[model samples]
Target: MTPWILLPRRVVSFRMPILRQAFALQALHELGRLAPDLARVRAQRSLEASLQSLREACLTTLGMELDTLTLFDARSVVRLFAHAEQARILAHLMDERARTLAEHGDYVGALSDTVYAGQLLACSRQRFGVQRDAGAAEALERELPKPGP
Candidate 1:
């Protein structure tokens, strides 16, 4: 009788430009998550250049157009920010088709943006304070939703 042996499958690694873009996008998302308010407006504004920087980084690092590469589908991206109140402010800034306060020469949109930004800032500060007082890194973790088992 011949002995039979199972062989491990060969591991293949391939470079994916879209994955890189997705990672960069995730970094941007994290920035938004960590600093939802205008307290870091300057830092957030710098991210406005990130989209272009991402494209350039892709060309230089991966020889690809990161902007052209679709990482997260539209629905997924929308869902990701759906629960975030600060996203309304970001949406106004990011949406090219959306009307702007400047376009209408009205203060209402700008005022709303400012108000939302303040709310986000307050929420972040409160969370930080809670974590600091509780002396537990996991304190704020409970405030977040748990993933499905």
Candidate 2:
């Protein structure tokens, strides 16, 4: 007979932090879409707080513990799904952050954030077969500063 395996309490604790981070970031993204100039300072503060919580969760939980581990492993399938969803949430958040930064005249920061978001989307495609629009990333990439002579 097969045995029933249970997840560790520590791993279970990871869910709420992940859910909170996702919700917070999603709200920031929605706000940016609705009003770019308005509420940006609040959005920035919210993003920073959520990211701090996310950082702690990643350290304590299994989040990003094994970037070397591929998504094909059956044991990590649940984590893979959870992380994929987080990636989507984070990509949107970073995209909105980039827009907000650009609006504030922080071009370099905007480019950096935009690039990171693109990388996350690329990873999402590899892990979860979720291919977001590449055109958006490319459009932002074009606006990045060119190499100087």
Candidate 3:
């Protein structure tokens, strides 16, 4: 687990980028579905880039001391929770995107996204508590292709 320290000054920094990436991913999904083959490829690449960025933002806030959050002012703690919520939303979005990718036969990319989203969901459970997203994660896990013997 990476050691995380959440300072008051650092609280507001991550929200915008993560939110922006989430929106971009949502937009790219629509474009990827409707665009020409070449344009679809470009949209997929851009979506991947946005997903990576969002993952990094979430990673930075994970592994923090939940007890230590009380040491900070209330505002910082609220911001931290908001950031975690944003991460949760993006993880679900990624899971949806992964399902689309799987339907289109991009199994490798689909698997990667599904696994990463599961990790994010697990981290959310750890950082907070039993989240409502557990069932969704289980559904995604079941959707993964079974390995060949």
Candidate 4:
């Protein structure tokens, strides 16, 4: 009698999980710059580890579970993968955060977050638009930062 072993087949994903996590991490780092206290707590953790960190920090930093965090915790959602629509959503959230910060006497923090939120808006526009005409492109070029010679 011959014994046979069967191998299971599974479809491979087009994108790698690590790449997804890297992108998420980059987004989180960028957004974290807006929420300094939150950023400081999450600085050392990787995106893969962040959900768990959030769970842990829930009690320690936030005084609630990660799942319990709400719009008041908008910064918590900044790590999500975003396209044009999500970028718009994040930009609005940041705008709201800036207002919140300004009301709380964090004027510098509000300004920094507002700038980052504007960057997010630019990201959204560039993602879904047609190529700019020469004049529009020139205007954008004048406004956008250019590398120093």
Give all TM-scores, in the order shown: 0.26, 0.40, 0.35, 0.35
For residues 1-149, what per-residue lDDT tens digits would candidate 4 score against the true structure? 22322222121243455555445344434334334433333445443343354344333422334444333334333333343333443554455555556655679967976887776556445543533223323333343243334
In the range 44-96, model 3's lDDT, one tens digit per residue, is: 66656544443433333333342243245433443454334534544544565
Q: Give the per-residue lDDT digits (tens) of candidate 2, residues 1-149.
A: 22323455656686877776565345334433433322334355554643444333332333443223222343333335444445544455556557666766779978976877667677666664544334334432342333235
**How would you order the candidates by TM-score, starting with the best?**
2, 3, 4, 1
Instruction: Give the residue spans of candidate 2 off by over 4 A.
Output: 1-83, 131-149
Model 2 TM-score, all chains together: 0.40
lDDT of each: 0.35, 0.48, 0.48, 0.44
lDDT of 4: 0.44
Most TM-score-accurate candidate:
2
Candidate 3 clashing pairs, residues 3+ apart or interchain: none
Candidate 3 segments whose C-alpha is farther than 4 A from its true place = 1-84, 131-149
3 or 4, which is superior by lDDT? 3
C-alpha root-mean-square deviation, candidate 4: 15.7
